[model samples]
Target: GTYRAFVDQLPRLDALGVTAIELLPVHQTDPQEGSYWGYMPLCFGAVHAQYAAGDDPAAELAALVAAAHELDIEVWLDVVVNHTTEVDAAGPTYHLRGLDDAMYRRRGDGSYIETTGCGNDVDADHPAAQDLVVWSLDRLADLGVDGFRFDLAAVLSRSPSMMSRLEAWARTRDVRTIAEAWDAAGGYQVGRTWPGTGWMQWNDRFRNDVRSFLRADDGSAALMEQRVQGSPDLFDAPGDSINYLSCHDGFTLYDVFAYDAKHNGANGHGNRDGADDNRSWNCGWEGDDGAPDTVLALRRRQLRNAWCLLAMSHGVPMVAAGDEHGRTQGGNNNAYNQDNATSWIDYARRDEFADLEHFVTGLLALRARHAVLTQPEWWGDALTFLDRRGVDGSTAGPSIGWSVGDLCVLANAWWHPTEFALPPGSWTMAVDTNQADLLDPPTPVDASAYVVGPRSAVILTR
Candidate 1:
């Protein structure tokens, strides 16, 4: 099937340490606009024929799964049950509208509900709608998928019973379920609710908070504190959020710090299609330039801050592809239509952005090395800290602390650099996010305090 070609890329992804593959909406979609992001769906039962492996689509899916299972990589299908691509009376009439238009969608005097603003929002409150969603999921479960990423998941919660039933059904199979838990009307909450029993969410709070911190905006530190801790304020559990600085919808991470205003002239929209309230600071220039060293240093630091937060945060961190190499859309935050070189990964510029890539690799490695960073648990007294002045090797508390066996993380987000006293014994520096020379020899500092660079992170192990 056509999907075999897509599955063939798994080995390369696996080589890069990608443990999971989040497939973008495999469901049938509009053949007209083509629904590039896969948010617009046409059918829940059928896989998009365009993405199928070959003539026999089901066989291709099975082969893809077998290959992925052999490599120990989990597949997460992107499912869009919120709305169908068949919108308006003039659009293509698909399964939902064809079966029972009145029951499948919410209507106000024969007009469809405009909640998703994609012409029509599915009336998930109806039993038929819920059945279709559950049936689609069951089909995927039988296909041996490891998980699902629900598109526009808040719409499901509009009918609590439907959400609850879906959750119960999902628990029967061993699979991860994630929800895009944000709504345009701000009706959705990130924590456990109707559909969030074992479901995680795309943490918009993490994105906004981290963006603010990278831009050095006012009150950013307070917002960042929540994001760093996995946004406990939003989620009931620690792992119920996906921390990301950039994704397919927003500006690329590099563009976030490089362009204050979006240049979307290439998209034929005259910059009207993208967001204007981007909390971005371009260091000095609005776009790319042969800038001076000082400007370059500032831009690098900003990138480092965002990357470090994503790596250190207590959630399933998702790095947008090419973010490691500082890929930019030439300041076009929304490049859904410009499927040219602007959106594709440029292998030639890998060396140009090598430093950023190395920084990200190092940060992720550091995170993987520390169980305290990833062990989905809420902060408590066990996660204690010791200040530089109080590092007497005592169990006494300082200001910050996290425990995972013999490893501990201590951060001083203060403006000035401070000394962190290590316990008496040999302690290795697993990672120093601030220092360029990550493999530099470990210096034997006073047991009373080791100097931590200003606004830096240090991973210490005894």
Candidate 2:
């Protein structure tokens, strides 16, 4: 899709109540390489010509940013500064490889060190490479880009000075920076180990634990509680964690409930490309095609429960595009090569899954109504984690309850219903994932206890 076409969709995103939109790599890539994901950067300073409808790609990108800002949405661009399309010695020579071989990391024999799984790794430790990255970011900031999400940021973190230099540059422009915090290789740095200070890290721990709890895995309730408390076990502040259920790389939220295993045969990799452990439950039947109505209803309830958990969590929530409307890729998790219907956001699903879309919108609105969900600091003494009986302790069962200020959230991951004892004041129900519609009319609850549905969540406010 062209930048103008993307501009037309900003209003729909605004209606979803998102404060920011992060686009995949917009940097120029080699047209001959046939890369659909744009992870292989050909030039850091140029915009991909295919994404622009007008003659000037830079101008069109600026226009896109302007349109998003008009809708009160901040635009964040994903940047790939780790590797390029120039693979190895036999690969095509781009500007950097042709000009200076020192741009890449090399061994004693002068062969490339492939830490990125892309055949070669950029030597971000080099001063010239650091200068090039800052220069490119400055050019992007000049065009009104609000922030950047670094792909494979662990590669850059390998250098002692690269992150510090980038931070110094970002401070002058007042732009935000986010880190993926891991590389294709085993360079894992998720929390304070990541070099960038004051930068948000994608909390994959939150994603995995939430998915495990949704599928009713053993010992997931304690992990889910840690994630719901903004992952105090991982990060220093709530804003340091960017919580998400799915992203461009993983299964869509709908597919998480519809498919047990990846159907990536279309990627031409023999269905062996995507991650093997997806932590997904098929809800008694795989693939939604001839599933019974009872299974379908359960799937919808599962989706709502996932969204409710994400929205109620005390970190910055991120929703993948097309996830709000039940978009499916035929169970293709690694769709990096298929640019056809498999990757495209089918707008028709908006009408097909209108109820889900409405539910997502309502959940976001409910999140906005509560500041405790997105606040920067920790919950500290104000929040109390409890069991279903309202006793304070580590939640070890399938049922968990928590009270923070005026709000109480109860979640039951069992196959049968569970009753949760309430705290002091009279409570009214604001959300229940079992119901198709949100609480259009708030329902008051009993003074002492409330029964939560099986494999669902409920929220009460006094």
Candidate 3:
């Protein structure tokens, strides 16, 4: 049932320029409250029977994979190997609990060590658990799936040796593995967690810093610089980060700028459900409003700013679904349970949505065109940061206190306009996130300076 639906939807998504469909946990989950994000997994070996067609679950999955492959789209599975749905005695029974309780989960003093905050954490240190995890991955790999987005991956590496072993096992496979490496403490020490070269982590630092800059926080400029260049403070190597402005969790990008405080009353939490430190700004208005042209202009510019930052950042860019159309959850940042219009992508708002889609497509294409932007190698010929002199220099060579190479990015986080003189050469104006008229046409004179609108970003290339 679910697989067939996905198979039918694959072509449409491809047409919309989606090359990957990251499926929420597909493993067997509790049947009653089963479809809630798939984080509450019950069986690691078996596919969720409800998603399968009739009794032939394997066949259904195989067919789905074949269809996606035919469209040249890759299927990425969301795996939750860190924990299981076996919460209490009332929870559903699965392979791990049935086979051997001790082999499946971690226990201390005869009590389950609940590191995942989801009742129980898998005993990754256990040899049996390791075997089960590795076997499950190998099974998916054999089925022609592309990669895995490991949910709560930090919990899987509670024991350092276990993380190392898992990384070693992952490297053997011909697929990509992305880790949700965030722990509860907000410490993004990727250097300590990542096992080796093959893993890429969700860069929370980038998300926070970029959001802070958009809100015009003090010292945000410095933080934004760190994020755009890939936080060397958090990550040890380059290209090991997945830069995202918004994701399935927390406030949508539109909501981030549309609301200063979360309105999560819909989640039955009386607005106390989600995070309070959202780092968002409402741009002088709270929630939704059919305001004047100025308000709409500001909102549009903010959206472009977030998109450009995500695309230009030094990492794998993850664009949350519906972000292109400025989707909002009506200020419900934590709409994990409210799976109504709050979570689904709104196909309405066609005009605004189309513009956003076009902007993102062009942004992605621009990034792809520049090898320095996406290359695994650090500080390649494609990226650069220019100082005032370099920005105003007559020649293209390196100027005082500037990182020069290919593309030059200018960001003006201040409320007032800022101007930068262009290097004396034919430099194409790549993007103006503020949607300002100054960015129109003729690629301003080589020696002439370009004005950046307040709270905006601009990309230039020679």
TM-score of each: 0.86, 0.97, 0.87
Reference-based lDDT, residue 244, model 1:
81
Worst 10 residues of 3 by lDDT: 394-403
Question: Which residue pairs does candidate 2 place in steric collision?
Answer: none
Model 2 regions more than 4 Å off:
389-397
lDDT order of candidates, best first?
2, 3, 1
Mind giving the per-residue lDDT tens digits that candidate 3 earns over 41-125? 7777678888876887667777888899899888888898887787644556665677777864545566766666567777878
Q: lDDT values of the candidates?
A: 0.70, 0.88, 0.71
In model 1, which range of ten residues has the least summed lDDT? 394-403
Q: Which runs of model 3 end up more than 4 angstroms from their true locations?
A: 7-19, 52-57, 70-72, 88-95, 104-108, 185-188, 290-293, 380-384, 388-405, 436-442
Tens digits of per-residue lDDT, candidate 1, 1-462, equal 257876766775665556677777777777677436667777786777776746766567767887888999888888888877777777778666788887546455777776675777788888877888889888877888888887777877778888788778878887888888766556676665525577888887788877775554556656655676777777787778888878887788888878889888888877788778777778788777776776766667667766766776777888777787788888888777765888777766778877777766666666777786778677655444454533334332212323334555545444455566555556666556565534455543335457655445566666
The prediction achieving the highest TM-score against the true structure is 2
Better of 2 and 3 by TM-score: 2
Write candidate 2's Cα lDDT for 94-168 as tens digits. Answer: 788998889999999999988887888889999889888999988999999999999999999988789889888
In Å, residue 102's CA in model 1 sits off its true spot by: 0.8
